[model samples]
Target: MIYSFRNSGFRDPETGVYNQTYFMEVFNREWHRHIRDHQSLALLYLCPHIHETVKQPHLLEFFMKQVQEAILRTTDLVARLNNNSFALGLFNIDEQGTQIVLHRIEEKIELFNLEYGKKYTSHVDYELAGYTCTPARNLRIELIFEDVESLTHELEMEKNKHIELRQMQ
Candidate 1:
């Protein structure tokens, strides 16, 4: 079945997953719900190394599908933020819980790499980076959204900085 919403720009045509636009929308809604209900939420940003391995377009699709299925839960939401980058919104989870969930996802990726790397005729390498946040009651959803947005941006900047430093070697 096609999983998409009305006028949803978050749906990626290649992997049939929600895109960043959908992520922000869902996150804002969930954030409001959490604020009202006093629940917790976590966000995970996943960067797959599929690009470093196979140049084949179809292989990337397969890799995305596998990663999507691996990390997603019935209560969780996943989005393709851009090429080789994905994000997850996990509701009602705290920082430690988020860490455990992310570890499981990492394990799944490793297992898939071992199982299908040779068969797919592609080298497999991947890395994951994530952050968790639980907003305070007094905080507005818009502020929380901005905080997460800035956090994500900072994380990407740090990653790029590290990459640049390594490349300078």
Candidate 2:
């Protein structure tokens, strides 16, 4: 018998990585695995800043592609969740492990900035927030963060403050 495989084709056309639809499917599977196996998972949400310096929208896509290439691991799930937000699902990992991943991503961003030269202004600046959970915890993974909106607001404020400080220099 001949086998015919069907592809879901759920990837961001611009970044060539999983889109939100694929991400949600993978995330649900990982969540189920975490519940069944008593494993831990980390959800990192990243928001990229929009800047006037970017002349073309495709450039933003290229920048995100660079980010995806820099941060993704064989086991990690990365996806573009929205126009300016991306999400990463780290399975069977702890807080420290998540921190290490975040650190590496930040380092890659810095390296990308350096490589792009001093005169070019980058269109993206990432603000990251995360949540960690395990099966044994008394808390519900979905309810761990009750106020993502406020948290994201605070992060944006903090980022703006940093940008203002840099402008002063």
lDDT of each: 0.64, 0.64
How displaced is residue 156 in candidate 2, in Å?
0.8
Model 1 residue pairs with clashes = 10-19
TM-score of each: 0.71, 0.77
lDDT of 1 by residue, 1-169 (tens): 2545663565777777777887878888888888778777776666656554355666556666776666557778888877866777888887677776766776666777776766766555544555455555676655543444455456556644311000000
Count clashing residue pairs per candidate: 1, 0
TM-score of 2: 0.77
